[model samples]
Target: MSKARTVRFHEYGGPEVLRLEDVEVGQPGPGEVLLRIEAIGLNRAEALFRGGHYIERARSFPARLGLEASGVVEALGDGVDGLAAGQAVSVVPSFSQNDHGVYAERAIVPASSLVPRPEGLGAVEGAAVWMPYVTAYGGLVEVGGMRAGDTVVLTGASSSVGLAAIRTAHRIGAAPLATTRTRAKRDALLKAGAAEVIVTDEEDVAERVRDLTAGRGADLVFDGVAGPGLTDLVRSVAPGGTVLLYGAVSGLPTPYPGFDLGMPAVSLRTYTMPETTRDPERLRRARAFVESGLRTGFFEPAVDRTFTLDEIVAAHRAMEAGHQVGKIVVTVPH
Candidate 1:
């Protein structure tokens, strides 16, 4: 067994319960690969895991928290072919019922979860890009069925996932309209290929969306916000358009009025990115899409800030603050 630093929760509660501890990194078994994690990407899901919000939980006494990482393969277990030791790789963060946490110096991940790291991309950026890109790509291309010249409105556009949607939309020739509360991020969002950036706080989101769409509303609405924001989103989608409800940032219970369902032909559906990760063929396709975009600069991962493993608590706090522009990462010991 090898030793690694990790943040674990003894009892689910707050970030305060997250403690830095030395843990044993066991060797990979058959069809597994050992990754010497170079970086850990932080997500809101981890915070939810710490707070016991997720339905999935660890089976044993102590559970690891992180889900994605980039690293070099230290060893490969039996039956693992075509991969050797000391290869640079990116770990796919999938929905797993059983697996060790990723927020450690080393982890035993399934061979299938391993993907060749994109060339010319740094280890830290690689770790940060996978989940968000897969999430956005799957939602827009796979679920929403967006097409060229389609106007897509993405709520919470400042989120890493939202920005990924922006990039994917533009790359696919869709007109991307983004919503962010802060004015300072507008230019950055626009530069990232958002056709229009609406200040949700200052501007009437529905009105602005209509104005941008020439009063036809958006063809696709990528809404991570729920509750009242859902109502606004319903109003923002053009008739027969699709509203992909992938996340609920507002935590507001969906309040779809009686007439709401009967009034419009809009398709509102819930999407989870991890679903695509579980299907091997789909995962490969998604990875191929993102990898090609990365090589061409159509997609880029932006890290707003980084913290050491010891500062995992601060990292989670920052993510909860909702002001981070892009992904936040935890740099592991090199």
Candidate 2:
């Protein structure tokens, strides 16, 4: 068939507005591969894009928003090698400008964007894996310079990316202290390899860090929630420690007390996964690193549930609910 049925948003607003309809699917051209999408990972960024708050949607209307998928290579375009048909694969959907999105029965993506699926990993897990794993790997190994025995503090521990950071830190022999706003997830966080779990609602997170580290504080901090959350993270870090700001889920800019930061001499920086993946070398390294971790059972994505293509509205609403742990996947099994 030359045409495919897919989900699309004509205008940005709420989940109820995203509609599923038929669209034309063209053959892959030059290093591209046509995939029968088995699973499509859902992320908070996609939610922002749907609501028109994301930077990627700076252009006009009728955008198909999804960034990661896992499936089999149905057909390969010219100049592609070593990749065969019906081979299970996980892909990072970084395609832009007139490309088929992952939230469909079929999608055409670049071969460079596809990576072989790890042994014993299923399509659902593969779909939800790349973004969080790569984000954590890039920040912890490449940007944060996390070392063995170093103490690290991670905020938003229940988040998929945050949990991946926790696992990555453990793999590197660093100490990971996770923070959660709710008590319900404290045990889950600890079981996920967090050395310590701090419930923000019940404890003074920064003070607890001082107690845990004997006042030296943490050596590195990975933060996804900005605003006041960053203030606590800053206070939790050691004098020479680095704080990496990667997201602002609170929708508030970080408030930094300049005098204290300057007096104590701390390093604060921001990072984005796209920036790290922009360089082909860095991207390849990240992909290999994550695949190795998955193969070794060191890294596993938390998938809460799966939805069909027609369930687009409910899927979006579920994401908005904020109760899901890890990644939410949308399956389009044709």
Once model 2 is optimally superposed onto the true structure by TM-score, how far is the C-alpha of residue 154 displaced, in angstroms? Answer: 1.2
User: RMSD of candidate 2 to the true fold?
Assistant: 1.8
Clashing pairs in 1: none
Error of 2 at 185 (Å): 0.8
Count of clashes, each model: 0, 0
Give a tens-digit lDDT track for model 2, residues 1-334: 5777777888888898788878887888999999888988888777787787765662655778777889999999999998999999988745652354677888888888888987788889999889898888888888898899999888888888988988889888998999888888888888888999999989998899999999899999888888877777887788788889888777776687546556566788888887657668888888888878888888887898999877878998997887777888888858
Give the per-residue Cα lDDT of candidate 2 at 144.
90
TM-score computed on alpha carbons, candidate 2: 0.94
Q: Per-candidate TM vs. native?
A: 0.95, 0.94
- Candidate 2 global lDDT: 0.83
Q: lDDT scores for all predictions?
A: 0.83, 0.83
